[model samples]
Target: MTRKRVLCISYQFPPFAGTGVFRVLNFVEHLPDRGWDPVVLSVLPGHYERGTALDDGLCARVNGSARVHRTKCFQGIDAMLSLRGTFRGNATPASAGQGETAGTAPAGKGFWQGVKDAVTLAYRIPDKQVGWLPYALAEGVRICRHEKPELIYASGGPWTSFLIGLALKAHFHLPLVIDFRDPWMNNPYDELNVGFRRRVNRFLERWCLRRADAVIANTEPLRTLLADTAGSGNKCHTITNGYNETEYVGLKARASGTVPLVVTHVGNLYGKRTPDSFLQALTRLIDTGRLGVHEVAVRFIGHVDEARINNLIGSHPVSAMVTCVGVVPKNQALKMLFQSDIALLIQPDTRLQIPAKLFEYIRSQKPILAVCGEGATQELIEAHGLGVVADADDPEGMEGAILDVFRQARSAEGHVKKDYMAFEAGALTTQLAGVFDGVFQSSPQMKNG
Candidate 1:
């Protein structure tokens, strides 16, 4: 069978390790099995912003499976930030895997910082990754002309990929599929975009949604939200972020809990997703003599937003109990996740979004202690009986949840078994391929082309 070609436009790709990379990475790997050839278009490694972690293992996994074209980006912001860091006598993009306490103390939220943020918000129209548009657009056009791809699949957080896809669709008259891993305008982190910038984002979101032939959201709630905006509810689908079961082929959960109960969070903590409440709960547990100071160990295995996370952890009494492992390779991180007694998730204020790490946690079968309010994350955890959930604001509840997990681990019953075949990457990719089939068959653009 002749596989239909899809030009996958994603700003986040392998080597640049983060939650953002996993969705598209999985799709790229599995799309071929479903009779779709994925041709990925991404930014070069140098174009990646500061604090991005590289995973060579992941990069190698993609090699030869599909053709990947990486283009250079205009690094205006990177240059400016690097220059600023040089002047400030700090390292350029703080080195990863510096062990626990690997961050500098957060600078004061002064007038200058406020001004800088305002200026950045005003200029970085779609996002900071807007710098990649021109280069990606050129490369996309070249690919369309040479490779003659039948469809365009654009995944976003760096929503620039959508714009690139839109431009290509306009030029080539091909079917376009846009995937939203996170909300653009309705994003809970309003601090990043507000006033005029926020309004501009809403307009762009509607503009792209109207143009795309199919829209995919990683969460069902997000699918509903996008469906309302797109005004074509039927076209919007929920093909969620799922685990790569093949990655867990030989991995096994620990037979028993560690000496000091390890509560591991495998992803980055930034924005409003801080460990403030979790740390507070830990402190309370120690104060009340529920959990000893050295009895429970909390590990953050990925990136930690220097200012927000470190400053908070630095002053906290539970700092000694917490370890930030910075960013490790994908395999190492998964090993850490499986070996831990409990997996900690600090998801607050985001209702529609579910972090990619959640699926992996499900695969690990380790008890998840999610400090999330009422949303998709909470609902999934509760529905599956995965573990415990405590709202971030409820310190007492979080403390209790942690204590409960500790006890369960101590009793050697922390591992959970749940039916998650629906959350597997290959299954999810089959759904994506089904979407592709419908779009290709129904698309007037493809017919005309």
Candidate 2:
């Protein structure tokens, strides 16, 4: 019964979908059925075909249970202008069962593929965690001397996969676990769009969370803002971002509630998670006609910043009841949040607390309106009674909680049971395998001790 290896360094996995690499690729694709053996160290598909998430059956269920090293995604030209603003603001990073040239990558080329894309920003391919610090410290000293791992999980988009698990925990002093999917220097937009290369990435996230043994955080208000900026708030914890019941029953068997009364909203919109005070209270109930007998359709998918959505349609007033589907494809944004009827989540009133798309907006229970700020994403949408909880920094209490969830969808008239589609992504990856067995059984008995 000896199995607990884990070496999961990530740079947005599963074909690199957007945001916090699918909770460390479903904890290295279900931490080898509770005994653990994950050895992932990602970033491949020639410049992350728009940030990974192409399931060839989730890459044969994570290369048939972990040991999936990729390395080789160097696009620097500001990561190719953030992948040409996520493929000209349509955010989807490939795989519609791959066709269209197996999705992305032949956008006109020549001159030896533009001199190997200008020497892939100086090629270093140490198993491709980009910015190859001595090829990620020589593949973190060959995966700490051939996966002698006990625990060394690290994640990030470009925060250099937490300096490749802080150089394999400073070369073998093991049990490390640093995983801050966001929040380095408690980001709330300060300092040149949080750059000076994130002040050398907050001095490598304070030397890997003061030399980690455990620092997890995905949001209990970013584990109390990274334990009050590593002054040690009980060494930071929280393991959130769930919803998987076999990828929400394969997204409710190829979704499509036909469309219309939609009112959706997926991810990536910055500086106060902008929805501009619930589109200025749905443009004052659609220019005072008070959306009576509802025919609403607000959508706004992802990365749509057409000048911050034409400044949220010239400062709202139902900006013609917006529908700017800019960045689709996370299976068409979960089949438009499984035929949405209202899942409006918006946050950033100082990173309110949790927002890994609020666990796929609580499994798309299809009634969330949350405007943010009252913490723990309004107590996990009032402990999953899931529906409305406004105030993206208050506007008449976020327009009286979106006109009381549009008066409970104009006095209900149908069937429902949407606890965000009753969660279960393998029981939320076995509650992140009980937070990696309460952080390697409260580490410090160490493999490097």
Candidate 3:
């Protein structure tokens, strides 16, 4: 069978550790098995901010046959400052300021930082990563001219990648599929500048959706939201994030006799998703003698605000029991998940979003204690009988769920198993392939392109 070639425009790719990278990586890895050839076009390393340590292991996981093209983007303000210092033979103003670190904002520049942030926000349309759009588009066009790919798959935000897909669709008349890792204009967290900026985003989103051959959302709700926003439900499809079981090969689950129930969370926390509520629950459990301070350990293993977490823990009696391991390698984090008695999943108030970490926790086979509002996360937990879900705002409910899991751990029945075959990466990739097939077969432009 002749495999259809797909040009994948992803801003975040392997060696750069992020939740965004895995979806593209898994898709590219499994696409070949489903009769598709992926040509990845990604930004070169060091162009973007690093949230976690790079994992070369993930880079190695990309299919050997896929041709990956890495390109450089225009440098950011901080990088330009460093370059100016190098040429001038003096410390940059940002670096020379008292308590100002090399890469971070100054300690006393709250006002200046706010001004700079506002300026950047006002200038950068869609996202700060928009600076990479021109370079990515140039390289993408160059590749299309030579490779003549049948389809363009652009994963976003840095929603700029979708713009690149839009441009490619115009230039080559290829079938452009925009993958929304998260909602664009409808994203609850984004602080879009009112008036002109917000209007531009809305226009850009509508324009892209109108031109897209198909749109892929990670959840059904997101698909519906995008379809409704675009006023076109014909091209929208849901393909949820999933786990690659092959990564867990040769890793043993936590031994049954391990003492001190270990509850582990393994991802970044931002916005409304914080450890305060969970910390409060732990405090209640310890105060009530339901859980011993020494008998329960809560471990955090990713990019987290240390000061904020410490402040939250300071008010709690179980302060010593909470440990933030910071960010570790992907395998090391997985090992922590494997050895955990219960995997902790914290969801914010957003009902439209689902964290990719839940699927990984499911892969751990450890019971999950999801602190979430009523949404996809809670629905998946209940549907799969994965574990207990407590409202994020309900401390008493959270405490009760934790206690139930603790009791189950004591009885060696805490590990809840579910049929995860459908959530596996390979299976999800096959479903995505089916969508690609459907779009290609149904679209007049795709058939003619």
Candidate 4:
């Protein structure tokens, strides 16, 4: 069977390794089996902002799996900030979402810092990723012209990709599909969504949804939130972020009775997603002699605000057991997952987002210790009997939950045995291909194809 070509406009692709990148990378890697050939359009690696971690392995996988086109980005303030060493990651502080989550304005900022903040807030239209639009759009036009792809898929958080897809659809009259990894207008974590910027985001989100041939939200709650804007309920679908099965092919789980029971978190910790409460809870566990410092260890294996997180951990008694491993490559991170007894998930107040790490933790067969509030993350953990859930802010609840996991770990009962087949990347890609098929059939341009 001849696979139909699909132009995938993703702002975050490999070698840019992170939680979000895998969704696009995995889709690209698996779509071929579903009879869809993906042609990825992304920014040049040189254009990736400072602190955006790269994984050569993921890059190699994409290179082997698909035909990827890279273009130069208009790094204006982004380049300036990178040079200034003030900003980190692919987003400016003002474009507060993705890895750089939004937070309340810090007290006592210097005059120059305030000025920079004001300028960034005023300039960030749609997002900080807007700088990539002109470059991606031009390259997208070239790819669409030459490849004549059957459909277009644009993934967002850097919602700029959707604008590029919207433009390409306008130019070529092609079927366009948009994937929302996180909520835009109603993003719970985005406290900076206010005034003119929020209004602009609202307008852009609606405009894109109305134009998109099909819409994908990573969580079920997000699909419901986007359904109204999507115009038709059927057009918007839920295809949750999933784990790639191949990542676990050669990896072996740690023997059930490993000493110093490891509880690892494998993503960025920013904004409301902090470890203060968890550390406090762990401190209580240690003070009461429930969990010995040397008996259990906590490993944080991704990007974090080093100074802030260090301060939080330093003031705590559990700091002795806590190890901030920092950001490692995708393979190493997964290896740590296999080496651990319990996997930790920390999310508070976020209602719609179920981080990609959740699926990876499930795939590792580790008992999950979810420190979160009432939301999709909590719901999934409870529904699957995957592990224990403690309220994000309640230290007492967290203490009890940690003790529960510790008891289970001591008895060699720390592995999960729930059905995780639905969260596999290939199966999810099949669902995505189904979406592509629906769009192709319904599209006025492809009705006869």
Q: Each candidate's lDDT (Cα)?
A: 0.84, 0.65, 0.82, 0.84
Work out the TM-score per prediction.
0.84, 0.33, 0.87, 0.87
1-449 in candidate 2: lDDT tens per residue? Answer: 45787888776677544556667776777778888888877766665644445544356557778876666644454565556546546634463223446555544335435655444433322213455444556665777687677777777545667777876776676666777766656556533333344455566567767777678776677787677667787657776677655555656521334334667888767665677677766666666775632467787888756576666558554555687787766767877777776778777555534767777766655667777777777787778667778766566777677777765554442125654433445565666666667777777654235
Compose the digit string of candidate 1's lDDT tens values, residues 1-449.
76889999998999887778988998899888888998999988877877777777788879766899999987656666566556656533453223325365444326447756665775467887888989999999999999999899999988888999999999998999999999888788746787788788889999999989999998888889899999999999998888988788777776684587888998877777888888877877777877777787888987786566567766656778777789787788999888888888989988998988899888888888998988889888888888889888887788888888777677746654677788998899999999999999888765666
- A best-first ranking of the candidates according to their TM-score comes to 3, 4, 1, 2
Better of 2 and 4 by TM-score: 4
Off by over 4 Å in 4: 79-118, 188-191, 304-319, 411-413
Candidate 3 pairs with clashing backbones: none
Best first by lDDT, ranked: 4, 1, 3, 2
Model 4 scores a C-alpha lDDT of: 0.84
Clashing residue pairs, backbone N/CA/C < 3 A, model 4: none
Candidate 1's C-alpha runs over 4 A off are 79-119, 257-260, 286-295, 303-326, 407-413, 445-449
Candidate 3 local Cα displacement, residue 2, angstroms:
2.6
- Clash pairs, candidate 1, are none
For residues 1-449, could you state the per-residue lDDT of candidate 3 as single tens digits?
Answer: 76788999998898777788899899999999898999999988867664445767777887495899988776465554455446546656655576755799656457655655665665558776777888898899899999988788999877889999999888887888999998777677876645677788888998988889899989877888899877899889889999998879887887875888898999988888887888888888888888787798889898788899777767566878888898787788998889888899988776777889889988888888888888777888888888888876777788888888777776656754668878899999998898888777766665565
User: In terms of TM-score, how similar is model 4 to the real structure?
Assistant: 0.87
